[model samples]
Target: MKNLLSLLTIAFLSTGVFAQTTWKADKAHSQVSFGITHMTISEVEGLFNEFDATIEASEEDFSDAKYTVEIEVPSIDTGVEMRDNHLRNADFFDAEKYPKMTFVSTSSEKVGEGKYKVTGDLTFHGVTRPVTLDVWHRGTVKDQKGNLISGFAISGEVKRSDFNLGPDFPEAVLSDKVVIDVDAEFKKA
Candidate 1:
């Protein structure tokens, strides 16, 4: 009986030591933005006003972190009402049919000091494709309220054609490549 109790105690302590920590994005401090070339002349920038992201990690350096993100398609804003509406129509996102874009990380590899290469499956416009994004772990700190917070700057590029986004549009009208940039802060939860 004493041996069984010892084993149980050891198992409980091991589980605690290996427990994963979860962090949720602090909405007010996070932004999901994208940029695309327009008319082969200038870049048009936009952002999704509503998004949720979470990270799970067991290491302090976040080398083993898993990330998941969901963005509302109808929340896209380009600072122009007409353009935003157009983007939501069938010519572009078709937000009525597909209202959300999501990404679930399959792997995260630490390549340098505070730098990571994250690969994931991204689902948008009713299509799922593999994508790799560069991440800069901007470190973590304790807030004034004693809450732990971490910051990340993530960037990636995706071909709109791959996701059937604006299928009829030519590269001349709008660049096929779109750049995604996210500046996010996560509070430990």
Candidate 2:
């Protein structure tokens, strides 16, 4: 009985130590942006200004990192206010019905030095799809408050039609594929 208790104590301590390295998103320093082909020659780009993410990363190695991110769809901004307003309508994001989109990590593995492949379930427009992002660690530093800060950039592409945003635009003007970029900073929590 004493041996079993000792083992349990060690296990609990190890879990606590592992969790201490977690970092939460610094919303002011992070942004999620997306771009889609418009007219096959031009691109339309937009960004979500309000979002949050939680990251668990190892200071010694980035492969042990994990992330979960949430984005507010209504916060999207394009260069033109009219275009941005249109995108928030039912024809596009339908922010009134689905105010947010989320991505939760399923797996994270290192592909090369400071580079990784992160697989997750991405939910958008009430549909969920498994997606993979090419992630790169931009390094870590100390903030003004002396908290550890880490930066990462990830990119992926998803088919907009898969999420039921298919019939909104004419096929000639819009493509189904949309590319997403995530540039995030995390502070040790």
- Top candidate, metric lDDT: 1
Q: Provide the clashing-pair count of each candidate structure.
A: 0, 0
| lDDT by residue for model 1 (1-189), tens | 999999999999888878899999999999999999999999999999999999999888999999999999999999999999999999999999999999999999999999999999999898999999999999999999999999999999999999999989899999999999999999999
Candidate 2, 34-134: lDDT as tens digits: 99889888999989998889987644566877778889888999878998888889988899999989999988888998899999999988999999999
- What would you estimate as the lDDT of candidate 2? 0.86
| Residue 93 local lDDT, model 1 | 93
**Global lDDT of each model?**
0.97, 0.86
lDDT score for candidate 1 against the true structure: 0.97
Report the number of the highest-TM-score candidate.
1
Deviation of model 2 at 74, angstroms: 0.8
| TM-score quality measure for candidate 1 | 0.94
TM-score of each: 0.94, 0.87
